[model samples]
Target chain A: MLMNDKVPLIREKALWMRRTAFTMVHRAQLGHPGGDFSAMDILATLYFGVLNFDAKRPDWPDRDRFVMSKGHATGALYSALCAAGYFPEDWLQTYMQPKSLLNGHPNRNYLPGVETNTGPLGHGFPVATGIAIAGQLTGATYRTFVLTGDGEQQEGSNWEAAMVAGHRKLSHLTLIIDRNRLQQGAGTEETSGLDPLDDKYRAFGFDVVEVDGHDHAALLAVLGAAPASKPRCVIANTTKGKGVSFMENVASWHHGVPNAAQYDQAMKELV
Target chain B: MATVTPTAAGLQDCRNAWVATLEQLAEADPRIVAVVNDSVGSSKLNSFQKKFADRLINVGIAEQVMVGVGAGLANGGRIPFVSAASCFITGRALEQVKADLAYANFNVKLVGQSSGVAYGELGATHHSIEDFAWLRPLTNLTVIVPADAWETAEAVKWAAQHDGPVYLRLSRMPVPDLDIPNRTFRPGKAEVVREGSDIAIIACGTTVHLAADAAEVLQAEGIHARVLNFSTINPLDEAALHRAAATGAIVTVEEASIRGGLGGAVAEFTSANQPVPVERVGFPGFLPTGSTDWLFQEYGLSPEGIAAAAHRALKRKA
Candidate 1:
C-alpha cells in the first residue's frame, strides 16, 4: 500500500485492465474500447491507489464512491472491478452477452461499485455531486470520484454539476475528466472544443489540477493530496487507445469491437 | 370522518404542502434531503431550505444535473427529493429521469412543481403538459399527481416510506381538499369520489374537482356519472379503469396533455383489455397565452367542459 509499491502494481493492473477490456468487448461483440482503453490507467490507479473502498462491501456508507459518468467506458470500469475483486475476473467474458449483467452501460442493479446507470452523456457528474452531498449530510469521511470523457463534458449537465459542487463546497468530491480528446464521432476539438477545460472548472470553484492521465505515479501523487475547502477537478490529458498502436488516436475505434486480428494485435501490444 | 367533502374552499397550493411536508420530514429524519434546480421560491421550498439549510441542495437551474444528483444522493444512502419545475424536470432532463432514477432504480423522489399549465402565460416552454407522456412508459417509476394539499402531503409521506423511485407532481394552482381530515394516500389505487352507473369520469390532479362538478351537472341531467379521482397514473388502476370502461362510456380528465396523461393511460389500458367509447379531456397541443384559469377555461377544463365531455360520452344521439 506504500506509494513506491503501489505505483508499479497499478501500472501492471492497468495493463491487465486493458487486456480484460479488450477481451470483454471482443466477446460482447459490442462495446466502447477507445475510451475504455484511454481511461484504463486512471481506473486502475483509482481502484488500486486512491479509493478507500473494499470491493466486498460496495455499498459501504463510509466507503469512497466511484461513478463512471462516461458510462460508455464500462469496459474499463468492469475491468477495474475485476482487478478490485468486486467480481470474479472471469465475469469479464460474459460482458454484453444476451443476459450478461455486463451491459454496454454500467448498471448498478447487476454490478457492484456502479453508483448509477449511465450511457446518455452528461449524466454522472450530478449524481457524483449527490454522493458527495450525502457524505456531507451523514458526516461520512468517504470521498466521491467521477470520471467523465472529455467529449462528454460538452453535455452542459457536467458544468451544472461543477457549479453545484463549487456552490456547496464539496471538498470531499473529486472529478477526473478523461481528456483523451477523442469522442465517438471525432476529436473533441473538432466535435465541440472543451479546451480551457481546466480553467472552466477552476472558475466553477474547483481546485483544478492538470496531470498526465496515463501516468499512475503522477495520478496517484495528484489524487492523493487532500482536497481544499472546495471540490477538486483533475484534468487528465490522455490519448485514446493508450496501449494499442492502430486504435490509438483513432476515433473509429470508439465503439468498434476489435476483430480477431485486431484483438490479437491489441493483446500483443498489452503484453 | 370528514365525509370527504372534496371542497376547494380555502384552497391551498400543493406546492406549499410539499414544502410543509418536506420541512416536517427533514425535522423527523435528518437523512431526508431536498434538491432543487434554483427553484427555491418557485417550488415553495424557501421555508424548508431556511429551516434545514444543509439538507436543501439547490443545483442552480440545471434540471438534468439536478435529477442525476438526486440519484447520486440515493446511492450514498441519503433520501433526496429533487424539486424542479415540471416542464424542465420532465421535458429538459428526461433522459436523466429515465436512466438515473428509473433504469438505475434509485430511491429518489422527483417533485415536479407547477405542473400542467400552472405557468400558463409562460407558454409551452414552461408548461409541463408532456410530463405524463414522457414518464408513463418508464418502468420502476411510480407517477403520482396529488389533487390537493392533503393528497400532496400524503403522497410525500408515501414516497418517503416507499422503497423505489417516484415522481410526484405538485401544482401551484390551488385545489380543494379531496381527502378526509385524516385520510392517507395509497399509491396505485384510485379513489372513487362518487359512484354511479350511467357513465364514469376519471380524473387526476387539479382536474379531479372539475370532474366532480361535471358529475354534479350530470346528476342534474338525471345521469348518475361515476367519479374516480386517480392520483397514481403509472400503476394505472386497471380494475377501476376496466369497471369504468364496463360502464360502456368513459370520460377521462387531467391537467396534462391528452396524449399521455390519465386519459391516454385509460385508453391504453381499456384498448387492450376492454375497448369502449372514451372521451379524453386535456390539452390537445399548441398552447396559447392566458392566465391559468383562462387557459383552463379555453382548453375546456372547466366544470362545464367536463360535463360536456361526459355528455358527449354518455349520450346516445348520433
Candidate 2:
C-alpha cells in the first residue's frame, strides 16, 4: 500500500536488468553498457512499479506507450521488455545475433513494446508527441512517455518536438531526460552544455520535474502522476554506469563491452 | 519551344484535388488527420483547417517533428497525412521519413506539395528534382506521382486506404486531366495514356501529359509513339517496363533528376533485364534563374524537346 513498498520491487528489477544487460553486452562484446546501467533504474521503475501495460496485448489501444529515444541502450530496453514478459527470456540470448528481433536499436516492427524504431537520437520525443496528440484528439485516456539522453538534447529534433508539445499543451505526454551528464567523448557540460536543461524545458512550456533518476520512490511519484495541463518533463539526474564502480562516470563506457574479470566484478557489484 | 506551365490558368493545381480528397476521406474516417509544417495555404489545406480544425496539426515550419509526429499519430491508431512543401519534407525531414515512417513500417501518408520546379525562380534549393532519387531507394515507402487533378484525387484515396507508408509527391503546377477514360487508381501499375509501337515514352508527375503531347507530334511525323504514365516510382510496374522495352526504344521523362527519377528506374530495369536504346530527359542538375516555361524549354521538358529525345532513342534503335 505504501509507495515505498514499490521501491524494493523496482530495486530488484533494476539489479536484474543491470546484471542481465551487462551479460548481454559481455557476451556480444558490443554494447553501450554505461548508458544501459544509467537508464536501467528508470526503465525498471517504470515497467515494474509505475507504468500500465499488458505484455499479452502490446498493441492494446489504451495502453501507455514508452519510446526509448536513446535507442543504443538496447541492453536496458531488451532486458526490461523481457522481464515485463513481452517476450521469452531466451530472446535476450539472441540479442544482436544474425537475425535477432533484438537489434542494436529498438524496432517496433520486430519487437513488441517498442513504440517506434530509433537508433538515431532525437527521434522518440516527436513520435511520442504525435501519439499524445492522437490520444488527445480521440479523447482517449492513454498517456505517452519518451526517454532521451541528456546529450541527446543537442539534437534539434528534440527541441522541435518540445516546441510542439509545449504549444499544443499536450497534457498526456511526459518526457524523461536521462541526465547522465556524460556523453560519448566527454561530460555533457563540456560537450554541448545542457546545464540549463530544466530551464530549457520550462521555456518550452513544460512542467519540469527534476528527480534522482535512480531513486525508485521519487521516480515513481513523478512518473506515476496523472496527466497535467502542460506536457511534463522529468529531468532525472543519474550517473552514467551507476552500478559498476569502475564504469561509473567513465565516458569510454558509453559503448564499452566488459572483459571477463570486469564482467564478473560488475555482476557482483550490481546486487 | 516554350511549354505551358502546369500552374497556368484554366488547368488545376493537384494540391486542390489532394486537399479536397483528403477532406472527403477525413469526413468518413475519423481516424484520418492532417499534419502540416505550417503549410496550410501551400498544401491547400486551409479549408481542412476550417472544417476539421482539431484534426489539422500545424507544427510551424518544423519538418522533422512533422514527419515523426505522423508516425506517432499512426501508432495511436489514427491515419495521418503529413503534408509539407516537397523540398523541405523530402530534403529536410529525410531521416525521419526513412527511420520513423519507412523503416518502422508505420501506416502514414506523407504528401509532398509543390514538387518539381513548381517554385520557379526560387532557385535550386526549393526545387525537388532529387526527391525521386532520394525516396526511391527506400523500398518500403510507396512513391506516387500523380499526373493531374483526377489522379491526385485517386492517389489520395488510394494512399488513405492502403494501410502502409506512402509518399504522395504532388506538384503545385496546373495540369489538365489525362484523356484516359475509366482510369482506375492502381498503386504500382502504369497507365497506357496512348498507344504506339515505334517508341515508348515513360513519364510521371507533371511530365505525363507532355509525353502525351509528344506522342501527337510523333504521330504527325508517321512515327507512332506509346506514352506510359508511370505514376508510381518505387515498385515499378515491371510488366509494363517489359512491354515498354519491347518497343525496341524507350524515352523516359520526368520533372526530376535524370539520374534517379522515373527515367533512372526505367533505365535500371531495362539495362539489366532487357537491353534497349534509352534516352533520359529531365533536369541536368541545378538551374539558372528562369520562369517555369523558360526552365522547361531550357532543360528539354517541353513536347518538342521530348519528341526530339524520342527521335534520338529511335535513331539509336535504327
Among these predictions, the greatest DockQ belongs to 2
Q: What are the per-residue Cα lDDT tens digits for candidate 1 across B40-143?
A: 88878888877888888887778888898899889888899988888889988899999999999999999898888888777878888999999999999999
Ten-residue stretch with the least lDDT total in model 1 chain B: B1-10
- Most accurate candidate by lDDT: 2
List model 1 lDDT by residue over A1-271, tens digit each. 5775899889889988888888888877888898998899899998889999888988777888888989989889998988899999778878888788888788899988788898888888889998898887877899899999998898888888888899889999999999999888888888878889878888999999999998899999988887679999999989898889998899998998888999888888888
Second chain alone, TM-score for each candidate: 0.94, 0.97
Which parts of model 2 have CA positions greater than 4 angstroms off? B1-10
Tens digits of per-residue lDDT for model 2, A1-271? 7777888888888888888999999988888989998899999988998778999999999999999999999999999999999999998998889899989998988999999999899999999999999999999998898999999999999999999999999999999999999999998988778888889899999999999998999999999888879999999999999989999999999998888999888878876
What DockQ does candidate 1 have relative to the true complex?
0.86
TM-score: which candidate is best? 2
Interface RMSD over true interface Cα atoms for each candidate: 0.8, 0.4
Query: Looking at model 2 chain A, which ten-residue stretch has the lowest summed lDDT?
Result: A262-271
